[model samples]
Target: MPNWLLPEFIADVLPSEARKMEDLRRKILDEFRSYGYELVIPPMLEYLESLLTGVGQDTEIYTFKLIDQLSGRTMGIRADMTTQVARIDAHLLNRNTVTRLCYAGSILHTRPSGLQATREPLQIGAEIFGYPGIEADAEIQSLALASLKAAGISGVCLDLSHVGVLKALIASDPLAQIFEAQLFDLLETKDMPGLIELTKGFHEDTRTALLALPSMYGDVEILKEAKKILPDTEGIAKALAELEYLAGQAECDRVTIDLADMHGYHYHSGVMFAAYVPGLPNAIARGGRYDHVAEAFGRSRPATGFSMDLRELARVLPAAEKRHVILAPWSDDEKLCRKIGELRQSGEIVVYELPNSRSEHDEFVCDRFLVQEADNGDWILKTAGNE
Candidate 1:
């Protein structure tokens, strides 16, 4: 293989896509900042235990582990930033009042999440800690929607779920609790045959409810049907009510319910959601209430957040227009140099034309030129190719 060949599912972002991704990153971060989410930057990697503290098997499978030379402890390249931000909130910031934090960075996964997915994803997200109400969940969901809107993605559908619904059912019966992991896997895949075989020996009501969960996905009306069929446990009731409220509060084109959605099931403690756009079958972004992560760090704060791969998002967006630039001749003249500096400071892209070379930039088009007036010798701007 050629030395320049990248690994499978990994590729370099060229100038055009990189520009779009950077622009989206800035706009989304600004949207996050506008909501008072203080930006935080965590390390690219951390101790294995710290990275895996409150995440599930999915994240564990994604993380890339390494032996740290300094401490001889296992370190993991972060596949997700949620827990790291939670650690900062629980241990570092140590704020007693409500705290809002946001982060943007690249994360490495051992394998691609989908056939078209990249192993290295640019992740950006925001979290709120110390607030345990459904209102926090609502805010996070709204922020996720707004972030997509900032990126110019439209026709979004918010898919909502709650881990508590399944948690309640499992906790209500010792038999179900014993097979919790199995049930979780089956439900995530919606493997009816497997769920049937696994739940055959359970209580009648437990088996019935477990079977109904997979089919309980649709519009918000599914919540009403869930209320009628599912066990009326306190946990299930609270989870359903929260979903209904968020569905009502969601400011998007559509809202959906998926009672059996087990994404981040082990990681999220309450309502979870994924955003879907028009073209992609997979979710564009995912988030939910994860109040358990801080507990792993010994602070026990309620946290909710969402993250998306900017590269994946950029792939769907239309290509950005080539930036317009003013071609300036490289010169030692003080006035010419000063004029170039002024244009740069004023947010114009001024490219210097080196001697014996033509201007070349893949991401920019030289539509204007800086020239000295023939009569006055004063530097001025003129349209390129006019002369």
Candidate 2:
């Protein structure tokens, strides 16, 4: 085999970081389990058609595709797990009602140039299928809050929005042609002036709303202010009401009203939101109602879910220290090694002794080794440095 190179955006996780990631993954999975969300392991590789069944065109562009050698057909690495779960729920599960499913895995995508985003992200999220109404939205939001707390994040700011509101405002025939691309660019830059320039010829009401978007973020009072300006848009009103409900249901102090925030995922229809931490520019978790995605896959169901980027979380988490013990066995200390193995089996970190001179023992003492003595008939364990 010829020597190959890892792509620029792709790299392997080292042991220290991997261990931290595993611990975080377990903590998140445990939280999901506590909420009665059964874990599902979807295939890392899937048929292009099946995976693309309901994923929007924008997201589809990022997926890495290739031809399958065995079947002589096209397949793609999973760019997003949510779509695969939707397919499973629609076809395999065959349930028409709500199903709570959770998952933690790596998602692959092409590394976009000039972006800090990771191509391989570790995600842990839950999907609630076949539930509709504000109640479903509130439940997902509540779960997200709980999950964030479980992951040891505090002071979380949840930015909420309705895709419907923006879609309604941009639904004009003329603007529809360039709405998506222009909106994406504007949102990413948070450029109110650019948004105004693009929507200059739009209807008065729509233009006013679009321009107000960048500043429509703040406390709940901002929602009331928005209601006064933009009256009778049921989509916006409904979104605000849902946010109100969520505010009351979740820890109100952690929730913030951000009307300007738009979901990148096209399938998101009604309420969408993202949770942010202080030091991270990108959201730690995000999800919202994507009711129409199931219909695209030949099954109609309402769904809302959120996923955390474990890699990012691990990066911000404090360094983990291991509890360790070193067993210094003598020539006749085979029994001591067995005893040390027992402690190890009980989850203690143990390092068996290597042959050593007196200087080695001095080094162990200076290093503060948790030494187990086995030279005498009776075994003793103590910190060598302390002694």
Candidate 3:
């Protein structure tokens, strides 16, 4: 490894990209605030046990851990912020009523999540706590769609799933955790052949429904197909109804269901969804309902939210907007300084030239400058190109 080389999957964000990311962050946060979601900033790291709450085995693998010298306990750098926010809701605030929270921060993953993913991602998200109704799921999904729109993102396709379908089946025929883990891995990969081989001993009805899941994906009609082929149980019926309602309320251009899309198997208890925009190989945003997450923090609260990488969103968005700049000389003239201050206060970027240094900045468009029409006279603004 060379001294100047960065670790694989980690890269620096230059000024232009950072500016765009910040701009979008502010816009999305403002949108969340409008919907009554107050912002909360969680620390980058926490005790290993607390951080692992409400997360799956994969999240633990993705996390980077260290020994805490202060407390002699293991600490883990956050790979995701949702569980931390849940801690705040359950242990700290302990609010019984409905509470909405939002956060923006950098999460460090042990490895890149996808082929084109980053190990360090700036995650921006919002969560609704203390709400368990299907409406809460709908609200979060709608909020995610709105955030993308606020970021100038279009052509978004939202893939929806309700783990309740599978959970219902598992409840009827409980299996050992080890066997369930194998089932989860197979479903995660959508490996139908492997799934068929593994579930060969299951009852005919259960096997048929499990097999039907992989292909029960597409538009809203998939939900209809699911109800027909899957076991006629209360959990399945309820999940199908909830997905149908959420799909209608999503307000997105396209919505579909993936029955076997149980990405958050251990972490999420209800609906799971991923949002994709055109040209992005992986989902730009993902979220779902994790009703049991709060229990890890000592109180079980119904929660739902979504998170997206600001850096990834910035990369796909249009170029950052260029700002007009007024470049002026470094001087002690009180009036000239006052005028520059006024321009800056009025939201214009004014760059002051340093004494005995380079006078030109290629980065900014210096179309205007401060000048004095005559010596000992009032300062005036003039076109730099003309003067």
Tell me the lDDT of model 1 at 369: 91
lDDT of 3 by residue, 200-291 (tens): 87777888888888898899988878888998999999999999988888777899899898898888989999999887888999999999
Clashes per prediction?
0, 0, 0
Q: Each model's C-alpha lDDT? A: 0.92, 0.75, 0.88
Candidate 3 residue runs with Cα over 4 Å from true position: 174-178, 359-363
By TM-score: ranked, best first: 1, 3, 2
| Cα misplacement distance, residue 346 of candidate 1 (Å) | 2.1
Question: Which of candidates 1 and 2 reaches a greater TM-score?
Answer: 1
What's the C-alpha lDDT at position 92 in model 3?
Answer: 82
Model 3 worst lDDT run, 10 consecutive residues: 170-179
**TM-score per model over all chains:** 0.98, 0.86, 0.96
| Comparing 2 and 3 on TM-score, the stronger one | 3
lDDT per residue for candidate 2 within 231-348, as digits (tens), equals 4566667777877777667663466777767655466888888888877778888888888877867888888888878887876677665534455545456666676677679876
lDDT of predicted model 3: 0.88
Give the C-alpha miss distance for residue 92 in model 2, angstroms: 1.7
